[model samples]
Target: MEIITSGRLKNTIKYLRALFIIGLILSIFFMLGILGVLAYAKSQGAPPLAVPQTSLFYASDGSIIEESHRGQKRYWVPLSEMSPTIIDATISIEDRNFYRHNGFDYKRIAGAAIADIKAMAKVQGASTITQQYARNLFLEHDKTWSRKITEALYTVRLEINYSKKEILEGYLNTIYYGHGAYGIEAASKYYFGKSANELSLAESSMLAGIPKGPSRYSPYENLEKAKSRQKIILNSMVSNGYITKKEAEEVYQTNLAFFKSEDLGRERIAPYFQDAVKKELLTQTNIDEKTIEMGGLRVYTTLDPKLQKVAEEQVAKNVNPDSEIQLGFVAMDQYTGEVKALIGGRNYEESPFNRVTQAERQPGSTFKPFLYYAALENGFTPSTELRSEVTTFLYDDGNSKYTPHNFNNYYANGTITLAQALALSDNVFAVKTHVFIGENSLVNMAKKLGVTSDLVNVPSLALGTSTVRVIDMVNAYGVIGNGGQKITPVFIKKVVDHKGDVIYEAEQSKEQVLDPNLAFVTTHMMTGIFDAKLNDYTRVTGQTITNSLTRQYAGKTGSTKTDSWMIGYSPQLVAGIWTGYDRDERITLTAEKQYAKKIWADFMEEAHTGRNVTAFKPTEGVIGVYVNPDNGKLATNACPISRLTYYVKGTEPTEYCMDHVDHYEEVEEKQPEEDPDKDKGWFKKIFDWF
Candidate 1:
């Protein structure tokens, strides 16, 4: 050792004293700064920290179909509801000295700082569970000195204001787990398809490993990385005395059943209907999108789960999965306008475009009822006769001509009654009626009956050239089904807040848009469509409506080159079905399988299984009378073909048919002014006498 002089010893001592004083002043200033931060945070008061809850959608039968939330899906639960294994695992991995610390783990922070300094980069985080909770709740996730100080002060406040158990519960509930899941409850359910209390040791370890770097250790994203993190968590658990080494090893070796992210919402019974309800919630209430996503409102809808299931099954049974055919089906209570079931597409997962509420397609002859209703609203009756021969209509300043033709080009080519025209779906008769009663009248009638789609004022409007949505079509038919009462289709029945207070409730609205007698008469005319032979107009020979259903219901069949529709209603339910390709390509439905009608019939038969078989009762001012089918005149004993037809009281036929006579004496007496069949040949004259 070298010998030290007195002057050098004195100088070294002075330098040591000066360094100690400087360190002492610096320590005092740091303590004062920390105190200032704590005081400021305390002045700011306790943070409003709560986990986001999931909003639930329930069917009319009180079964949950969907749980919707924004940003992250979270389900808050008490700490006692969590598996003890999860709590132990989380502690072992996140903050081993959590119970012993005040707010920050000073020893871990020091170690992490040293490690980060050695690496010459900020590669480590020293946030405890409480510190994380503070940052997640009150501070932005920015790696800045001011943010860190604010987080530390908030962490201290949280420790002072809450118990160790509360802080841990909050931290576990608010941490972001990968795959849009938050909280142990949601993560456990998402990963294991079970509640937190039912999570096994392996699942708990897996979830505990996710919080460190959720995306990095997401089993859905990287199975190997997640497994590595899980193994590390198991080792930590064993080292921290939570479990034995053998137990940890056994858990590490155990296979974990992971949930498929694709199947996250598979339990949702009717996603398209749920989507409709979600949209309606936004439109019908003052609830903002953010609040609706986060408020955990219980949306109660009028979706009859049984009917919805039937609708889905019927569509699946009828539509070929391999084919490009898509279908839209809607069923609703006729009087209440409550949508009981809705199938927007065959599979909502493949496409979420809801056809029922979104798609606007040509309604074809199914739109004839609105035209006929308009005619009846005017001074026309079912007994009114029109020539159903080929006719041409000029439009667009006579630049284009449209000649309507019946299916298979089969027309009566003579006088056909309104009832027969509708039953036969005679295109010429409908076009004549559309022209007789101006296009404005038909458009107005359609609007009043709930055809919300644009109805162009063209002659082809009689043929449903304009487009309309399935929901609007069902609602319009529901007008006739409900005996002339206009009803708005209602899906959501009620919505309640998390506290079970009624936030929104649907009220039934009804407007009498048509005369009850006219509606009844129109419905009766539609009933004739189901008849195998309408007096003389048979239903397309080999294609009879009788083959579709044997029920006492009224409906119309509509088809375009590419689209086919069957919308009908009994007094109880109104249902509509549409089938077509997604593209504008034609589809030739086979006679053996009329997909729309078959689907409708099957669903309707089941839907009416337990309900009463009530017939449509005619309202007052509506009367039935027999008329000659050939000439649409009052029937006489000599008339060969006669059928009973309904009419609005004052519109019934008053003149008897003069085509046939009972005897020669009656014929001569009735035709004294001219010889009967004078222009006939001698054989026909003798035949008339005989």
Candidate 2:
């Protein structure tokens, strides 16, 4: 019995010594681990923290317009923007020692190791919030030793360099929460159908349970399992002192109306405009595709939702769907050069081609305004006469003889004032003016008015034979509508980067390129198209639609065999539309020919609704005069018809209409018919008295 006892004592001593050695080795390893972490943290630099996120587009009214992103559904919100409940719940469930730990929780690790040993399988995890974040950011979710060691390294570096709040924010923003949702904000929105800031305690607890096992805990997939997990989350919250035990119980019992819907899955608004903004982002910033998709840029645009809706409505209502005629429309604030509305085609979905800024169609007679403005610049008054007869113009040193015909081959066959010709849309008169002023005059004027399309130095160019973009035409019209100020269409007002920093902003400026007086006169000249008073041999081009007009608008209608264009403007807005077949098919239907004027009239009248009805205000350097439409001279009472004309301060016609004056004088000067009989004196006088 004594020998047995002695042997047992020795064995027990050996056992205790083994334990002591093991303990000492563990202590040494722990110290080395700490020192290794310190050394590694000192050596490792921070990696980029930014992840790809959605870029948001906003309208002028601060309403969300679009969301652009790559496939991932991530949105970065700062810690301040996140709800406190979410922060607390996440910390309570993810890493209780999130604030106190250097990188890992040794106590938690030991507990998990015991748990795994008791289970005889890897059934538990001991990852801290920082460890999980590091794994998510830099390593894959493999149980391999290499991945675990790498995760450990990253966690130490993160804890050493980044603040706790930043680390928590990044983890919350990037962690997957099922249903394609990444981050707490997205998950909150997905499950609760509300922003993270708006989530209730129950909703917060419900979402906090998702990141652990998305497919299993997602309310959308298995509400029972999700509710089961919610109890655990609330219990954890109670344990972490985030909530009282009773509060946790109450939250667990509360029924939640889960809204597992996503905004990213909804139909887009203003699809074409979104595309345009995206394009502008691509070219304007010159950034890579990955950045654009993930840049989280906030783009503020000049899109006026009301006006855009109206523009879309007018085009859809006016266009014939079966006719296969495509259309492009643009509306801009003439004063500010803001493109308020746009349509690339009859249907953007059918064809993605943007005719507004892409397709170049012949301007036809709408090009007359630019020519007339050029004439005004070159000392041509509104009363300047051009023969409306079909005439051939010889240019290129008389080597080029071009004979242009009027609309329907009809002409005044007599000289007509510029205003009269404009009203008639007399093509012969326009070409003649184009030739008289030199072709470069029109080209230069068009450039001044913002026509970027190629305009060749040819006589037909006068009659708008040159093809120009609808947007460019509208922009040029903005110049006239803004009283001769240089203008260009501005799509984006401001752009903010992923960090909410201003990256780009459109510069606002106006340069007066045309004499304000001449521009006013030019605008006045366009008004003739709607006036029947200026009709000579032909009715005013806008005569058919004049009854629909509510306010004074200046614009011209141009029709080629294929294309129909109406470009008009007021002080408030300038818009242009083009309607025709894609192949330039001749518009044989009468309805097709009338589309421009009708649409223009309706759009302008509706767009101008509720606004102050004011005529195009003239500058001080201009004066108005009543002139004879036929003779282009100052009008007198004897004249049967006169038009209120505008001209530069001293450019008004000096001579009065002598034809009417002379006729009136001749009638008054003629002696009475009975003068001869009266000379028979007393006898005739007595007979007359009887």
Candidate 3:
């Protein structure tokens, strides 16, 4: 019995020694932890923390298109602008003790811990409004202990530095309410279209409910769920002494009055122009954000809303399913180079291909105008003669010879004047003229006219064998309208940031592309193609063309084997149109007209409706003249019936063709009766004259 007692005492001593050793090790560990915390706290107190920078995008009209943070739509407003109802509702739902508690609400945290421990699942939340705001602004949404610790630290710091009002305002502005919205101002605009000051009690409650789960309570996402969540927020507001019970019940019974902003998330009519404008914005502003997240941006663009709508409607009406041809078009104010309209494709949903700015297709015979202009610039008058016969161009000694053909197989073997060649779009005539003018000179002429493509100096290029875009073509046509001055197309007029600062402005300038005399000669030649007196129909074939032409205007038509094209201009406007398969297939050909002319006609008609009907002022360098049809020179009685044409001052023909040089004479002009003297006069009608 004495030995057993001794062993028990020895065992007790051993146990006490082990406990002392363990306690010493734990104390050392605790000291190390405290030292580490003190060192970290000291380091943090002396430096500013690095945070992520946000990028922004703007429209041509200077509206914001996007901001950098995902699911964040912050439109910062001063605390003075915030509504009292919104303030109360937010505080009641987020944290009623926000005014009294420091960032770390020890009582709330202990209560949450107790509840979580009882439930055996992590289902409790202890974050105050200030804590949540700090986390949202500076910390990532991580469900880890380390992230929570950082959130608590930042919240404490924020409270120490800022007033309650400032902290509340920050909380209201930085919290997410879903649907890519961030701040109270943006949320108010998203759901109500107005400022936060305009929110009603019901609306405020509904917005307050969204912070917990945006998708679950979004009015656009689910109205029933949103209403349910709103009730919860109202009840919480009443319980937290934010509002009386009677007031809470009254507001809860009221349905939310939603405000939908017209400009906030809507797409523009001409997406191609918008896309081009956006790309320019990125290059100029160094903005790298995607377009979807851009809030309400007031984009002051160059697009004429009226013309763009007409172009869209025309494509929808004319591009039938059988043809499957898509259409692209662009219009611009000729004087200022402002783009009026742009249509990227038939529909943006089926394909987002921007045919107007990106697609490269052959210009076809429309290219003839440039070739003709090149000849005129190089001292060739309208009366310059060339044969319209089949001729073989040299390619290689062993290969089949290259022979250009006219649209119609028949041709005149004798000499044809330059005016006649252009009016008929004769392939052989243009190719021969290009050969004489030098390929480089012709290409330079095209480039001067605003053609942006890399053009090769090949024989086929005379017939527009080179590819070009609709925007470039429209601007090229504007060169003629500006009296030989070339202007770069302008889509964005100005870009202003959210703070109302103009960050960028469009640079508009014009440079002379050709001698005014040469441009006039080209314009004069084009006038013949659309002469009302020349067509069997006494009136113009298209109302768009007729209405746009009170004075001198110039334009040309083009058709590759598959696609059809038109680019033209008045003194005020330049427009281009193209119709072809999106996949580059031979779907539109022979007899049936494609969407090209229809879209062009429709867009122009609408664009010119309210605009001033003005004529192009004839420049001092040009002159009008009457000439015989058989020759581009002075007419004689022996010459066939004649029509009038114009020419540049020193470029008129000296004499008629040899066949009719001495046989014709000029005729005197005649005047019409001043009035119809019929019995339909007022006084005569009273007398019933028969």
TM-score of each: 0.69, 0.89, 0.72
Candidate 3, residues 317-368: lDDT per residue as tens digits?
7666565677778888877888777888877778888988899888887788
Provide the overall lDDT of each model, using Cα atoms, as 2-decimal numbers.
0.84, 0.84, 0.72
Summarize candidate 2's per-residue lDDT along 451-471 as a digit string, tens digits.
898878888998888889998
Error of 1 at 346 (Å): 4.9
Candidate 1's residue-wise lDDT over 1-690, tens digit each? Answer: 988999999999999999999999999999998888778777877765564567778888887777787657877777898999999999999999999998889889999999999999988878898999998786388889999877888898888777899899888877988788888888887888888999889899999999888889989888899999999999999899999999988998898888755474467788888888878888988788766787757788999999988888877776776777888899999899899999988778899999999998988989999999999987888878898778899878899898988887877777888887887788899999998988799999999998888788989999899989999999999998788887998989998875458989998766788888889999988887776446555462214446656467888888888888988888889999988877867887584137888888889888888888787888888888888866778766677777888888878888777789755466345433775576899998888789
lDDT score, candidate 3: 0.72
RMSD of each: 11.7, 8.7, 10.6
Candidate 3, run of 10 with poorest lDDT: 46-55
Residue 197 lDDT, candidate 1, scale 0-100:
92
Positional deviation of 240 in candidate 2, in angstroms?
A: 2.0
Better of 1 and 3 by TM-score: 3
lDDT of the structure predicted as candidate 2: 0.84
Order the numbered candidates by TM-score, best leading: 2, 3, 1
